[model samples]
Target chain A: MEAAVEMKGISHWFGKVQVIHDVDLSVEKGEIFGLLGPSGSGKTTLVKMMTGLLRPSKGVVQLNGEKMPSLKQLRQFGFMAQSDALYSELTGRENLDFFASLYGMSRKDRHLRMNHVLDMVDLTAYASRPVNTYSGGMKRRLSLAASLIHEPELIILDEPTVGIDPVLRQSIWSELNRLRNHGVTIIVTTHVMDEAEKCGHLALLRDGRMMAEDIPSQLKSKLGVSSIEEVFLHYGGGARA
Target chain B: MNTAAVVKRILKQFHRDKRSVALMVAAPLLVLTLMWLVLDTETSAVKLAAVDVPAQVVESIETEGITVTVMDEAEAEEKLNEAEIGGVLQWEDGAPFVILEGSDPNTSGTIRSTLQKQLSEQNASMEWEYWNGSSELGLFDYVGPALIGFFVFFFVFIVGGVSFLRERTQGTLERLLASPVRRSEIVFGYLGGFGLFTVVQSIIIAAYSIYVLDVFMAGNFLYVLLVTILMALTALSLGTLVSTFAGNEFQMIQFIPLVIVPQVFFSGLFPTEGLAEWVQVVGNLMPLTYGAEALRDIMLRGSSFESFQVEVYILLGFTTLFTVLNIAALKKHRPL
Candidate 1:
């Protein structure tokens, strides 16, 4: 019943140029919410606010009804930003161990979880190799593994599967669904049509504003289109302007 | 736990990046060795050119110095310009005219007095008196303590700045901020890990310069180590702080000319005694100035810690200010 993340009238500015306009969004606990938007749609900014890395200039961002940018609330999040953000000089296993320790996981827990995530990402063999030697897709999988190393209550992934191979993408989506079933709220940003279909709840955004917020089937039917892409374009066609 | 985790990760990263590690040690060692070789060589035999000097005078000067060539006055002047000769010993107006090349004061003084000593028995200009030290001090003795501070500051500043800047450009800094780690914790974590590395580096460099290179060491070795470590911390903290303004490693490299080069000029590497009064005030603003002075006082002057307490405290002061600014700079990424 509780919302995992809530944004009320959130507007942000970088100097004089506004990157995010007045927008209201919320994701309930245990649901797979997708923030579907094209590039420069302010999805990254919104996700950053959700993770408490940035503060809204005009409005409030809340996690579990507590004001964000709070250290206590930050512990609940496992954030995977778009840029991998990994130490390329470090081996994959070392990166995982580092992230695991930051969450204060026990040695035994770290050992087990590191293995589980590395196995899930199918990077078990290359775990000992430095990340710089990894392919782009391998790096993405490794980034995903690092985010999930702590098994936090919420996982915020920004374009989590952008460069992932199709087979690995499917496995990652299934893993995300498994996390959802286990009551871990996930908020992912993507422009992929099928990936948006996988989210239980989707918010269509254009520019800095949200165009629609609804289930994928209901949105497609309401727009009289079978594909999520048409529904995306239909709602993003200035209907909410 | 978060700070320790950060320290561990930095150490792990450093272990993996062997080139950077090698650079932190080797770059400074190479420069230090080159400088040692240059200054350590006994001043090469002074070269003299005989133009219009009497034959007996040329013979006497040769015994004290080297004879590059015998030529006319015009030819000797050309050799002086090309540095082929240290000086042209020749007559000008007739009273044993010594038209000497005066590029280097030390060499010119030697040439002038050597000629005068050979010619007249009464060219004694002034009496010599020993003040703070004896004449046993070599050129390396004068520059060694100051140069020790310089290299520590230099290598540490560059390594710290470029590494911290990499954290930003590579997005690991954002990654750290997104985690439960505090901004101050990140800064302190860097101080711990890099602090340890620089400690090891200081020991190696100071020991090598004092013992291996045989640079004149008169005072306490422990004090040299202490000053070296503090100077390293100052550079490391200041490097991290300045890296906040740099967007990439190249930008961090750009800081060397603006920051490191000026400190060397004022850090007692060269004599600042005859410089303008305001220049001395400017020297006070540089962290290396205090570090070099502290090192000199400990090694050259043999002054105790209590005597150089002000300089030590100033080095520590720079470290603290830069660390606080580094923590503030992190707010740009996390804002918490």
Candidate 2:
């Protein structure tokens, strides 16, 4: 019932060019929420603001009722950037272990959590191989595994399934469902209409503005559309801004 | 515990990158060996032109490694003016009057000493006078320690700066920032990681220069190691600090002229006394000046710990300041 992340009238700019302008979003606890938009639609900027990685030019962001960019609230959120930022020179397991330790995990907890995430991502067999040796999909899975290593209450993933195969994408979606069932709140940013439909709730973004926010099915029914894609087209004008 | 993780991560990365390991070990040695060969070649023959000297004096000069050429006074003066002759000898009041070309003090001193020694053997009553004091040290000895400092500073600064910058531009830095780690922890992580490798680098380079290259080592080996390690720390901190301003490897390399090269000129490698007073003062502000001065004093002058305490502290201050600034710089990445 409680909102996991809330942004009120948030506006951001890179130099003079505005990226996110007077936007409002709320992600509820224990739900899979997606911010659906094409690349350069300010999805990343909005996610960064939600995770407290960037300061808003105007207005406020709150995480679990605590004012953000608070370090305390930041500690409670796990973020996976759009880029697969794993250390290429380090093995997948080593990368996971390093990030886990950064969150001050005890040795026993880190060991258990690392093995859990490796299994969750189905990367247990390749855990010892360096990340540079991983194929594109494997690296993406490993990066996702790393973001989930600490098992934080809220996880923010930016374009997480961009390069993954359909079968692997299905498995990742199932895993997100499983995490949600365990009361974890997730914020996923993607332009894939099918993925947008998978989220329990969706915030459709365009031109740095929130076009609509509701359950995906409800949004489609309200827009009198057969699919989430048509609803996005209705709001996005089906073309470049 | 965080420190242990940092050290382990760095060591693991170092082990994986074997080519960089080889470069860290071999590059300095290769350059140093070439310098040794170039600086240790045999001395060249001293050429002399004597005018109106007795045959006995000419024979004496010839005995002491001088190639003597007999010419009239006019011709001798002409040769001296042309710098084709090292010295000119003419007899006045029953004694030899020496007129020496004064460029290149080493050659001038060598000629004067060779001629005076020859004259003394010919007659024990021959009086000797030097054109200048013999207290000045050799040119090689003066610049040798500074060169050691310069190379160490240069190579380490460049390699460390570009590598750290790569970590950022490649997105690894952003990954680290996203973790729950404090910014200071990341700064210390880099310092500890690079510090371990540089310690070994410093040891190998300093030991090679001292024992193999046979550079002057008037002070204790431990002191030399201490100074070198301190110099390396300053370079490491400075490199990482400056890396924040650079967006990529090329931009990082561009900083060498603006940041690293001027330090060498001010590092006492060349005589800065002839420079304007303000220019000399600018040299004093450089970290390399203190590092090179301390290194040379320990290696050449046999200075004790007490003598170099001020320089040691200044280097420590620079490293600390740069490291703190580096942590502050990371705020640009993650404000938290």
Candidate 3:
């Protein structure tokens, strides 16, 4: 099978300020791929390109070997944006139902799928409550549930656990692991070091350029460093020198 | 199918927002009632026609805030029938005969009372007849139809624009565009959902104004509902289109002055005929201009559908134009 996402010679500019430089990367199927980058390192831009939200100025993005911006293939992946993009006035279950219907799911299947995602996100009890009343972490989990309501084969998440507590964050990571075990492809962008360490493969990005692409152990071991942060510092700091 | 999903989501959101729903229905009625109370006590200029009447009598009537135009009997009668002049004053057998265009009771009463005072000085009896409405028609009855159109347009524009802008600032619009839902589906879904709700609003406002408020209704109530619904749709489309340019709720409110306020000036609340040529053209461009005219024609004149069909078609045309522009604007978010 082809990689879940592939990008070659990708570059992007917003009205003359180039945000993403020439970069080539591929995400293999059925694995948790981490895009490790600092703020403004173009992680959001890169992931947006993969989801076809922003077309690259110069690159080809293919998902499952199909050239992207393909509406047919868009139904194959879920995307959770950085912000909780939900109607605060609507209950959590209503939000999920609305998203599921977008994918043209039938009523019975939608009910079943909605229940499954709500249970997985641990929001089953609070599902009927309006999202405005939800705490930050609960809203984050609800957003995750909405993205997964359609049960897409691939998922792209941007900063999914920024404001989340450590315990909930751990649960969310374990959920990712479970999904991967079931053969779902996942790509997550994060600035946190330990979260990068959890990925099956990592791409260290700085200044819109990929500094390194390897497994966490290989990247740290090869650099003679004790942690992913040191390996990142060597690449990021050395590049400036 | 995606459009239906969008429509469902919007309906759910609207239901949850009880304050907005109440504001949508109540605000218009409150303003209309307040206006009825205020403007009913106030007086307006009455234009009268004079045929073979003494020049001194014309000058005297003009002092009572009545504008008198000296013309032949034929022209005066024609203007009275068309409701151009408030009344016609003609001398027959050394007595004054008044033809009052009685659609506006305030105007007709003012003219009759003023004529009675002026003509009675000559020790002559003054007889008056109604050209359209009776002496019982209040000032509210004359302006009520136009007010209905204005309120519907105003409330829908504000409510629809602000909600759509919230969708943008809240990042839900980006999430929506990220879906496989087509841009046109978003616009049409807004239409379907908000359009249905506006239909309900239109019915309530129309019924309340005609039945509860006791505004005069000469035509079928169904036609009044139809015109209000179409006018609301026009407001919805234009509102969504304007929200595309507004970055926030405040910015959307700023458009009220630029978009909604001008419609008030042009929408038959004030007469547009005597205005400058370009001003009349500007009024012609406003949807409410046509809406108010259609409502007044149906409610006051008791006009048939064929008489106001042009306004119906024009309102639909405005909605279509705005909807197309809104769909095109979404291309900035996602090309496909």
Candidate 4:
């Protein structure tokens, strides 16, 4: 299988303070890769670098063997930032159409894509409502649908399901699995232990360092732990030791 | 103790953010000082041309501490027409016939009064003649063009800066940076979008100033539109450029005293004669200075397009420079 995303010796700094130390990671094509860490463990920073929103201080990020942040490569990925990033003044359909135009989609394609994504996120009924009137969960769902409107080959989601209810979260995860089955790569960053278990592979980060990277079950068995939480605490505590 | 805690927090924030503190306090003070200096400058003596005057009349006119240029009758008429001489005193039937350069009422009035006093003292019976087939206008007429330019610059700067700053504060700017769109495209898009509104705004403001307010208008209306549009573009670009430094809407408002106010002071709203050379240079650098000068030429003096070409070019240069700088400033958000 080909690697869909690659970061080699990636490190980032804000001013003089290092936020993401030298790190290497990759996501295989058609697989869901999860980066699990507590808040401030550099998950957002790392994801930002991969999405080309930020340039790493010392490393190269490539998508499909082409350098990332290349305008050409940016067209291949969808991004859902931690913040909703929706235009509050515009209606849900308008926001989707505006973003779709930016991707150079035809008018007909934009309409079809908007309907499809709106239905997929269960926001079809609220398509005409202004986003400022949306509840937090609905806004999150709209943001998710926006990321998928372009039907990018890779989707980078930063805490995509943070405020979602458990049932909705399950549906979102299942949707991710369905997209993966269609040969889409997904990179999700979350601190929730249960969410980590659903990824095909996981990178557990602590204090800006990777504590462990393996399949969820292998990471559990290697530490002789029954649950992913114990596996995290064991590796996290061992790093402190 | 609560008051003390609040005061301490305010002081700490000021110390941490020196740029905001400096702009808030220093910008206004600096502009105010410049205004004081410009307004307080001494008035220079008015220059007049004496045409075919008797020696006694010329001597009497020269006694009033005014500068007199002796010329032939035709030369004096030409000088008055060109606005080079404030007024011309020519002998008609052994009496004084006065022709005044009537564009600026203050200058024309000074010349008329000075000549009238000199002719009375000389015991010469004189009849005054009117030029341009009309009486002198009010001071408001002379300054109306500058006022129009100043208000457009003032309002557009505040509104554009605040809106852009709000976008930054609301996190929409970051979202824009995350897309595949180039930074230059965003800046150009803003220019294109806002340019549409400003066109209508300039037309309304210019029309109101000309037709409703009854301000002086001697040049073509289309020329006024050209100058107003250029002025609006300059303000728009500067507003967006400065928005990069402002963290919020309030901070954007703070720029009025720093950026917008100084332009008014130097925009020929007030006389800059006898001001310090450096003070005059500062006004020369401001975009509104050229705009106001060009507008006054078109509306008050009925100047032709050739007369305003330089100012038009300078205003366009200012807009282009500010737009490029604004695009560069966005690099702080996204390197590419």
Best by TM-score: 3
User: Which lDDT tens digits does candidate 3 get at residues A36-106?
Assistant: 98999999999888877788899899999988888987889999999999999999999998988888899
Q: On TM-score, who's better, 1 or 4? A: 1
Clashes of 3: 0
Give the Å shift of residue B179 in candidate 1.
0.9
Supply candidate 4's per-residue lDDT for A99. 73
Candidate 4 recovers a fraction of native contacts equal to 0.28
On residues A1-241, what C-alpha lDDT tens digit does candidate 4 reach at each position?
A: 5588999998888999988878899899998999999999999988878777788999999888887778777778888888887777668987787777667788899999999999998999999987879999999888888889889999999999998899889988998999999989999999899999999999999888888899999998998889999998997888889
When sorted by DockQ, best at the front, the candidate numbers are 3, 1, 2, 4
Worst 10 residues of 3 chain B by lDDT: B36-45
Pick by TM-score: 1 or 2, better one: 1
Top candidate by lDDT: 3
Query: Which pairs clash in the backbone of model 1?
Result: none
What docking class should model 1 receive?
A: medium
B170, model 3: CA deviation in Å? 2.4
Error of 1 at B330 (Å): 0.7
Q: Relative to the unseen true structure, what is the C-alpha lDDT of residue B57 in candidate 1, on a scale of 0 to 100?
A: 63
> DockQ winner among the candidates?
3
All models, DockQ values? 0.62, 0.55, 0.65, 0.18
For model 3, state the Cα shift of residue B230 in Å: 1.4
Model 1 lDDT on a 0 to 1 scale? 0.83
State the TM-score of the second chain for every model. 0.75, 0.72, 0.88, 0.77
Model 4 pairs in collision: none
